[model samples]
Target: MRGQRRVWVAAGVLGAAIVAAGLWGIGGRQDAPRAAAQPAGIPVTLARVAHEDLTQNIDGVGTVTSLHSVLVRPQVEGLLTALLVEEGQMVEKGQLLATIDDRAIAAALEQAEATRQSNQAQLRIVEQDLQRYRTLSQRGSISRQILEQTEAEAARLRGTLRGNQATIEAERVRLSYTRITSPVAGRVGIRNVDVGNLLRTNDSSGLFTVTQMSPISVVFALPQETLPRLQPLLGGAAPVVAHSRDGGELLGEGHLNSIDNQVASSTGTIRARAVFDNPDGKLWPGQFVTVDLRAGVLRNGLVLDSRAVRRGLDGAYVFRIEEGKAQKVPVRIVQEVEGRSLIEGLAAGDEVVLDGHSRLTPGARVEIQGDAQALARRSQP
Candidate 1:
């Protein structure tokens, strides 16, 4: 009876310990936290397609050239006596640029005039004698042949007088050539000759150069295919804007002046010229510039950010957001102006992805955070 009671007490203790461990495990399961669910959509920003008037432009690289360029040179040979204009001086048309020694020409002109006057006096005397001889011949005191010879002599003296007068005029013109003048209004370049330098008419170079800065011209070329579209804007004044090579500054604004008659066979391009009113002298001769030729404007066209348009093995496409999912939409790019693309195959109010497209695929869930209005607001100050 004592052994049986000891076994019952040990068994009771073991059973109580097991029951306590089971209760502790059940409480621990009830107290622990559950795992959170994964997000169903990706984070992305979306922008709505815009419909506005946009102008399409053709871009080209061109050089600023002078509208009027002249090389002042001596037409008569003499000692260069004076340089009236300094280097880099703005001069007007017909402005005196330089002078040569004119003493020799002046002296020759005077000699010619004196010879002409002396001949005129002798011709008058001859005319009087001829009249007397003609009257004497009528009275049979002088022979007919003598009268004829007197008349011939007077005619010869008149011819000689005419020749002398022509010589005087020639010398006068030669003297005028000694004074070199600017042929056109412009800023003068570096001086090639100094005062007292002997100049020749056949000099290969010139005394200096003058180039018109205001109302400058830019010469550029476009592919032959552009000529047809540019034809309508040719007769009329087409607008053109010029910028610095880096396109950071506005150089000037102008109109299309002319187009070449024939395309350059080697380049397969047609040359064009644009005129700018560079009153501030921003545009300079021989300067390389970026040219924008506004061909025409597309009215009420569907446009989007340039970055939204992507290229694949097929062509251009855009990732459009529809009902919280990305949908691939193929588009045709008509024109690109100022980072905005005029595209087809999309409505005016469609929402497209502007960025973060690499992580997106068709039917992929996305969370639209920003819209077009938000982007515009962020872009402003």
Candidate 2:
């Protein structure tokens, strides 16, 4: 009985020793990898939080629109005689664009002039006869009926002369319409009618379009809630900036020209326009762009590089460095533009991580990037 009990005790002791060794081995392996995984703290750059005035940039998508766009059409029906202007030609106000066949109008004007001359001659003859008849009637050499007939003839000839004169004026006005001129100063678009094509006033397709390019305007919409803020700055005082659709290039700069009187019921927004003196012709008609309207300034606020602001589950937060450790601080972003942001939670003089956030967590030890760089340079020599 004593030998069996001894054997059972020996087996139990060996089993306990094996279990202890296995646990120590597993724990040792874990500690080795843990120390190797993070031999040094995460290296990250830092940026200081500062307080300054930030300009509030209200961004929106807009389209470049011309203030004046006119579709050139013939005012009268006639065969297109000549195309004086070509497609894409820049023209001035009253500049000749095309001409209709004026030969018919010219012939009609000549005929009217001839009739006017004939009427004038007949009127002269009738007046002279009336004058002679009047003298004879006064001398009692003719009847009163004869004097009345002479006066009546003179009045009839005067009416004919007046009618002829009016016809001449009408013909002259029609003749002027034969020459088509641009009503506004602008660049002409595609030509719809070539020379020798008969054009009519009722033609559905117009001759072309004259679109003013310079002093151009961009039309955009803003939320209806912005009406009060936009109303007071509609006097061309608020500066407007335009960027390319990709926002890589600055298209032009201008000022707010006007705002819609009423908000659109369907869009819940109000329309506004900004005018630019597009001297370089960078702004083209019907081009889409991103607009930044300078509404106002945001007074004093905390400013930080936008890169430092990181989105977290709790909203926006920044990895602030304190005692060489990262502290995730929740922040409220007030305004963000370009590469800077105005935050509400953090105070001035707080250092936040600018980059190297791939392995960062709350309370993670961090090494200052500047200090690490200096140490590396010193060690190299």
Candidate 3:
């Protein structure tokens, strides 16, 4: 009777295991269908359009320089006697900066004046004698030949007087050169020569350097591909702002002063320059800076954030949202400025996806998380 009970227990356990297996398979199939039915929501952010003026700009590295720089050199050879100005002093035009030893020049000038006076006295004496000789010759008291000799002497004295007068004028000019003056209104650099130093005319080493910093110039080179677009704006009446190398600070505002006639062969860049009013003397000569060439406004254009524009096999494109799906629309970027891109082939009110574009494609369902109107409002004006 105990053996019969054991067999019955084993059969009951097997039948229970089969029933449990059947329930587990049914639950797994039911969960799989539920997971497949879940909706695939594309996480995305969107932006709306607004009307604003978009400017195209070219960025380049440049250098600051004084509009006018001059080297001070002595016009005549002499010993430097006195320095009237200190180094790095602001001087006005015609301000006396230094003085050379004028003793030799003064003595030469005096000698020339005395010689000129002597020649004038001798000329007067000769003239008086010639008149007397002519009168006597007409009265038959002196020979005509003698009168001719007196006349020749007077002529020679007059020539000598004229030559002496010219020499005196030249000597006076040389004497005036002893006082060296600033040729331009600017800040004077370090003096090359001290007191009692000998200097020469046309010396290779200059006495000092003067640079006019009230108005400064910033020069830069732009890629030649932008020449066509830049040529028109060059004639525009708007001013352009220049920023520092980091692009955070505004150095000054200036107009397009000049552009080079030819492009650089090595870099294919066209050289350009701008002039700024550096009244505070912030910009210095030879300082490297960043340049921004701002072209005038683009009217009635669509500008998208730089992050929205993407590159693909078909060229540049942006994932634009239409209805409830992401529509990858191909766009042609006309220009980029100030972290925004000016593009075509997009309407004014189209929605542009600003974030979560990696998995986006044509007809992909999207859910906009933020206020699209707020994004558009930020770019207004």
TM-score of 2: 0.72
lDDT of each: 0.88, 0.88, 0.83
* Candidate number that wins on lDDT, 2 or 3: 2
Clashes of each: 0, 0, 0
Question: Which residue segments of model 1 deviate by more than 4 Å?
Answer: 1-42, 133-144, 312-315, 321-330, 361-367, 371-381
Kindly give the stretch of ten consecutive residues in candidate 3 with the minimal lDDT sum: 233-242
lDDT tens readout by residue for model 3, 7-80? 99999999999999999999999999898866576988877654557876777888998888999889888999
Worst 10 residues of 2 by lDDT: 372-381
How many clashing pairs in candidate 3?
0
TM-score of every model? 0.80, 0.72, 0.82
Q: Pairing residues by index, what is the TM-score of model 1?
A: 0.80
Over the stretch 1-381, how does candidate 1's per-residue lDDT look in tens digits?
999999999999999999999999988776653322334578777767877888989889999999999988888899988889889899999999888999999999999999999999999998999999989999999899988988998999999998998999899999999888888888999988788889998997889899999989999988898998788898688899999999889999999999988999999999999999999999999999999999888898887888788999999999998887899999999888877888999998788887788889998888877665786333222
Error at 367, model 1, angstroms: 4.3
Off by over 4 Å in 2: 1-48, 122-163, 310-332, 349-381
